[model samples]
Target: MSSPIRLYMSMSLDGYIAGPDDRPGQQLGRAGGRLFNWLDGRKSGGPSGQVYREAPATGTVISGWRTFKLAGRRQGDHHDGVPILVLTHYGDEGGDGDVPPGHARFVTDVEDCARQARAAAGDRPVMVQGAGAVRAVLRAGQIDEMEIHLIPVLLADGRRLFDHLGPDHIELDLVRRLEVRDVTHLRYRVRRPGEAA
Candidate 1:
């Protein structure tokens, strides 16, 4: 069986993933750093630490070009020893200095990217990060589940994760919910069409 594709993202209570002016230096954007405060770098013990400790089990990582770029190639290595696919619309149109060869593969098609990642991942789950990647995979109807780390702070203006998804309503089955210090984690299984809710 193919690996399940799961979208994992840290979002503010108001629904913003990154604050305004999210660039290379400002990875999460203005006050967006607060969204990730609950992450204890996989160290220590607790619900938050459990989340990070479990992340490395993911076989493949999918990220948007912007997210990959902002990581400066270093932070992106957090997945440590896993295949990382960077989704971009431009398709290798230069500006690859930050991306080390063999570290990541750039793909233009979301569906194809997800397929390749799933195949490379085998039975292990594939983790999807970045707003653009999440949006693309979601629009393509490729995401099997979503694990959102909802932060309490509200960034009124910034990049929203659910923007431009159209008017269609996608159903989701809540699988898990956990409240850790500074954040609330939610896991939902994306309900497919005709599937009994």
Candidate 2:
């Protein structure tokens, strides 16, 4: 039993992960932070706090280069200083200007990145984020489970989480659902091919 690759993210009702024009200065884009308003760090002991704390337990993180920049290049401190594997087309030659040398390892292959992350994670789950990384993992059938913090508002324009999935249908089994504050937390287990329904 290898470590599971899990994706945890907040998305709007319309399936948008971030608002339109989600650039460096703007970060999550216009009013996109609303999706995460429910994650109140002040209430760390509460349910919202539990959700905030869950991310830190991850042993490794996988992200897209664009998302790494959008996140202000925090390295892996977001996951309590865990190793971060960045997926990029430029490979080692790129992302060094902002990410530094040892803070992150740049990899061109999505599957290989995930493999390294899993090995580093050991028994702990590997946290996957960034739209590009998530999409690539999905296309590769590498994701084991997912936790979606579904927001109430709808952002008509922005990056969608389920785009470019091709014609094949990806099935997921609902594991848990919780309505807390202004967001609904949904957990799902990805059903691999030939798996029981």
Candidate 3:
């Protein structure tokens, strides 16, 4: 069997992944970079810094069109050789031939994207980034694990991670929690609709 799909992302205390007015140059918006301060060794000690620096590379990355655009669409350097599958609408013009060879591909259907990602991942987990891709995979019941890095700052008005997940109730079982300075890393196992939390 292939490895499970994992949704891994960093968010603010208020559950926002990016601040308002996010754009090309300012991807995180005003002061939103604070959410990733720990990764740059600005807010943590040696141990935490090492943890961030020495983290294992993901096998595959799946992101939304907005994220792929915001990231500048570089080929090999973007995800350290890991293939990135971008999820976008079928008729959307932005999905055409933008990605470099051997780096990423455009995928329209959520389930097909997941299947391809799994196949590409082999024995490693497929990491899903961006709110749109994450929501799509989650709604499809394709995600098996969720690892959220919760930062200390809270952006009152921004794009929330779970803002528009419809009215469905998704349950998660807490698997692990670790405090790395000002950030809290939470790992959860996503449960099916009828499964107990």
Candidate 4:
């Protein structure tokens, strides 16, 4: 069986992932940097801090075009060695080459991208980043788990995490919750109707 797909992201207390007017240079938008203040001067080797120290053994990463372009333009291969599958209709664009050699590829279809990511992941889980891609996967019922790092900030005018989820209601079961400084980590298992609890 293929590995499951997991979506991970950090959002403000008010549920905004990125601030207003997000651009290439300012992907997180104005005042967005404040959301990551919990990691400043954070020491390693502590029990509560282990989650930050342990690198996720992700086999593949999936991201939306805007996220991929911004990250790749600013810092090449933001996910390090993990391969990334960028979902976009403009696959012929030139920015795709900014990623590490053979580390990233562009795909037009979301389902095909997920399938390829899962195959590439093998035993490990496929990591999906960015709010746009997360919403797409969630609407498709392709995500198995979601880990949200809730920061203690309120970006009232930024892009919401769940803005365009269509008319359907997606259900999630809370699996774990941990508090590290001002940030709260929430792990949820996606559940569909008629599925075993």
Clashes of 2: 0
Winning candidate number (TM-score): 2
Clashing pairs in 1: none
Expressed as tens digits, the lDDT of each residue in 1-197 for candidate 2 is 99899999999999999999999899898888888888764365765677767777898988888898788776445566788888888867556654434557778898898889899998999998999889998889999999999999988998898899777898999998877768887889999988888
- What's the TM-score of every candidate structure? 0.91, 0.93, 0.88, 0.87
Weakest ten-residue segment in model 4 by summed lDDT: 92-101
By TM-score, the candidates rank as: 2, 1, 3, 4
What are the clash counts of all predictions, listed in order? 0, 0, 0, 0
> TM-score for model 2?
0.93
lDDT of 3 by residue, 18-60 (tens): 8888898999987778888768663456545544643355688
lDDT of 4 by residue, 1-197 (tens): 67889887878989988889888779889988777665663565542365454336788888887787777432435446677887776664534544333567777778888899998888988888878888888887889998887988889988788888999777789998878677887889999867776
Tens digits of per-residue lDDT, candidate 1, 71-115, equal 875444646668888888777641464444555777889989999
Looking at candidate 2, the ten consecutive residues that score lowest on lDDT are: 94-103
lDDT of 1 at 7: 92
Model 3, backbone clash pairs (residues 3+ apart or across chains), number: 0
lDDT of 3: 0.80
